[model samples]
Target: MASHRKTRQHPKALKAMTLALAGAAGATAFDGTGQAAPHPTPAQVKGRVDALYQEAEVATQHYNGAREEAGAARAELARLQDEAVRRTQKLNAAKAELGTMAGRQYRSGGVDPTVRLMMSADPQRYLDGATVLERAGSHQANAVAGYARRLGSVRQVRDRARTTAERLERSEAALKRQRVTIVRKLDAAEALLDRLTDEQRRQMSPGAGPAAAPEDPARSGAQAPSSRAARAVSFAYAALGKPYVWGATGPSAFDCSGLTQAAWKSGGVSLPRTTYTQIGSGPRIDRSELAPGDLVFFYSGISHVGLYIGDGKMIHAPHPGAPVRIAPVDEMPFAAATRPA
Candidate 1:
């Protein structure tokens, strides 16, 4: 009887076991479409984020150029406006003097000078006296010519100011659009990074990642090419942990090009504010010739720059979420190298 009871389990218990097995099978099986969604790996996310940041940097440079143009336009407009005011004042004074002369002539019954001369009994004597009048008339004509020239100049200035203002407005609009695009790209990159797990985030960080390993002493110990180079490298080193702020050329924060420009500036060198221009500021050199303080550019468009600190390492303000830090020189695609000092 005991053996029989063991073989014949309760119906509810048997059903429960069957349902549990079915659920387990369903969990491991394919979905309704018989396909699985692909999840991107951390490395894939990093690569995409890097690309987004690079695009944003390109837009940043355009924004900077527009800002410069707008500033210059504003200054030029102010100068033109001041000159116009001065010219207008001179024109008003000349018109007032001409009006006074017209009032005197009207008060004298508006007789034509030539008619009055012909009507004189002694015409030759009248003609001789007319020399003094001729000289005065010539002076008045000169004054009228001066007023006309000034009026033409004022009109030209107003036209130029108007043109410049219109150009500035267009530039401002383009800058706004660029800023919006940059924000969208940065937001997408941040969302990608946010999807990473805590361990993945830490792993992706330049300060904590395996890629951030220290450089070999021998490679990092090369001497600077000059005193200026040494000073530039030293300045970059002093800014190791500052936050990366777009368009900042600062004592506390910087973008990639801004950091390099500021570093070189501290060394008594003036570099262009944008990576594209900064790359052209010095003679190009081969990567094999890279030394401390040499400027290393990255990407096909040369949109990124960093100061080489020897030992196959470089100091740079990496991106918005990153900071001024040392990284491998080959961290991204190498485009060119330059020696500014």
Candidate 2:
């Protein structure tokens, strides 16, 4: 009777064990404190998206530089090719004249003067004869020398054209690769943005929240140093809300350095097309010495730049999806500042 009673309770014990295992598996989702970690908030997502966009901007600058180089290289290649063609025409004309001279010599039974001189039995007599021959054929001799010089020049020009063509090809390849990198990074940033709710996207947009308040000029620590600087600052302000377009130095859109380059151009200053080159365009200055129209570069590689507009404020095209706007100078990591002369 005891053995039968134990057998009856076996199924109940098995059911209890199964229920305990399922409850433990459910509990594994929580932390040791017994609370489930929350999902990433909108602000966190925004920060990540902004970082990806910034990286894309860096690649965009590289792409712009490569494109400019490729353009210049193509122009150079075209010029060189034209030169080569002209040189070849000249060479062909000289060769034709030389051939005519050879035919005249053959018809007259006149051997080459150098060969005749070499086979001379009487050296003094041959020298005297050769001097008269040289005076008579001075025009033909000059043509021969000219042809030799032109042939050498044509060879050099052809070689140079070949080299220029190779350089242009390399530049074109680099531009394509940089463009690919920029697209990839921008796509990643857009994917992050897509994950956000409409309200979250709005909060993170430029000029949408309290953090996007208009910068107070009085609060800025510096002032425009010259009329040109002031004009640049004015131009930057006028460009507010313009979209950031990679490699654009334009009336419509701009990248980080493009905005600064265009703004300063309005002030009658020329800046290089890329951030790396632009950094070397002026004298380096301390952050405390910043003034309006001074370029404030950011990131360790100095890949980003903005025009300081005074009172610790700067006007910049921050990144893709963000327009030209005024923000505090410390919005990103500061690398250095420059004052264009």
TM-score of 1: 0.76
Q: Please give, for residues 116-167, the per-residue lDDT of candidate 2 as tens digits.
A: 4434687456445545555566766456556656767888898988898899
Candidate 2 TM-score to native: 0.79
**Residue-level lDDT tens digits of model 1 in 205-311:** 64743224444433466999898988898888788888888878899899888899999999999998788888888899899998898999999988888999887
The weakest ten consecutive residues by lDDT in model 2 span 208-217
> 154, model 1: CA deviation in Å?
0.7
**Every model's TM-score:** 0.76, 0.79
Q: Best candidate per lDDT, number?
A: 2
Q: Quick one: best TM-score, which candidate?
A: 2
